[model samples]
Target: MTIQWFPGHMTKARRQIEDKLKLIDVVIELLDARIPLSSRNPMVDEILKGKPRLVLLNKNDLADPKATAEWVQYFADQGLPAFPIDAATGTNVKEILPRVKQLWAHKIEAMLRKGINPRAIRALIVGIPNVGKSTLINQLAGKKIAATGDKPGVTKGQQWIKVGTEMDLLDTPGILWPKFEDQMVGMRLAATGAIKEELLHLDEIALFVIKYMVQHYGAGIQERFGVQDLPDDMDNIQEMVKVMEAIGRKRGCIVSGGKVDLDKTSLIIIRDLRAGKMGRISLEKPF
Candidate 1:
């Protein structure tokens, strides 16, 4: 599918971020733990060059723990400090301060050279929509410091939030790239709720989720849904139909036409999976 989605404000946002980068000591890039590489904007690598970076894989509680560990190692091998955090529940939030300190050691030394006791280090939180950027900021701030909502684009302008004694957060609105070059990347982003629902094909994305689950965590699916005799040669669409039929029976999503409403079934399955009701499943493996 040729996925075409780009908002008008993104150009302005990119320019603004480029302008703001000169004033920050470190770039704290937030990525969804479920699909880190796909969610990351390549422009960030270019714009954030020469600055220390901390890649926080947020919403890790919703992703597979094993995959999260692999991603941590992968980022570390690439010479970046990476941490898996669940911003919603504040898991592993305390570790960020020390990591930030370690990343900005040179800046700290520069402060000492100026005979100035640095009060706080400034960092920017950036990510695509619904990647838990505001959630992370609120977690680090220890309060509801940033306006957070379930939908994307809730944060419009930039806001500075005080996270701790010596750390401040620059929160920006979630921004999507100009175009998705990889089809798999687009599908993965759609599956994780990073892309707007209206722009996606629900049934196709649902099938993708089913296929991913069957490949990576089929046992989990069988255990959760109590489907003992799953077809071995079934494709993703067929597996999705099985899941939809089961869910339709469970939720009584039957129409007057005596057929399962695939649309409603798809919505139910996707919502449950995204909310971690199905189980913790990660879509991508660490490189």
Candidate 2:
């Protein structure tokens, strides 16, 4: 399925971010830990214009630890410091300010030499919709300063939040690019809830999730749903359908005539995957 979602507000958000970058000391680029690369907005590099950025792989609690490690190292190789954090639980969220301070240490030191106290670090937090950007900001500020929700496009405007006396965070609405050159990227984003569910075909997203889980997380899926026999062929559509039906039966998502409700089943599978009920799963790995 070809999936694309770029609302008019996103264009306005991009422009707003550009206008605020001059006053910002660093950019906090949040990403979904399960699908790091897919959740990353490609336009960020172009828009930030080489501003120093720290990558936080949010929702690491729901991602395979092994995959998260590989991703952290992958970004390290690219000269970006990437950390695994769960904003909801506030795990590793406190470290963000210190790290941002580290990035702007030189500027701070220069101010100190001139007998000037360095002001709070001005940081711009950005990411695609539902990637946990606002959640992280709220965690850092010790209160609910930014609007957050499970669905995409929740934060419409930008606001500056004081993260204690150490940093000032500019919380911007999540921005997605105009188009996705690779459809799989869109599929991954959809599976991870970064894209709005209304804009996607639930069956296609469900199948994509099933195929990936079957290939990379076979035992996890079986154990989660209590399915004994699973098809090994990822390319077999019928086998995948059977798997879905089995899960549907297990979850009691049945319709009239005893037929499985594939649409409801799709929602269940996606919800389970996102809620970490299927275990710590990473949809993609560093290659």
Best by TM-score: 2
lDDT of 2: 0.84
Residue ranges of candidate 2 with Cα displaced over 4 Å = 1-10, 146-159, 171-181
**Candidate 2 lDDT over residue span 1-287, tens digit each:** 22255466667767877888877889888888998888877787888889888999999999999999999999999999999999999999889988998899999999999999889898988877778766787788798663544349675555677888889887554454523458999888878887766688999999999989888988888898887788978899999999999999999999999999999999999999988999999998997
Whole-model Cα lDDT per candidate? 0.77, 0.84
In model 1, the Cα lDDT at residue 167 comes to 81
TM-score of each: 0.86, 0.89
Error of 1 at 23 (Å): 1.6
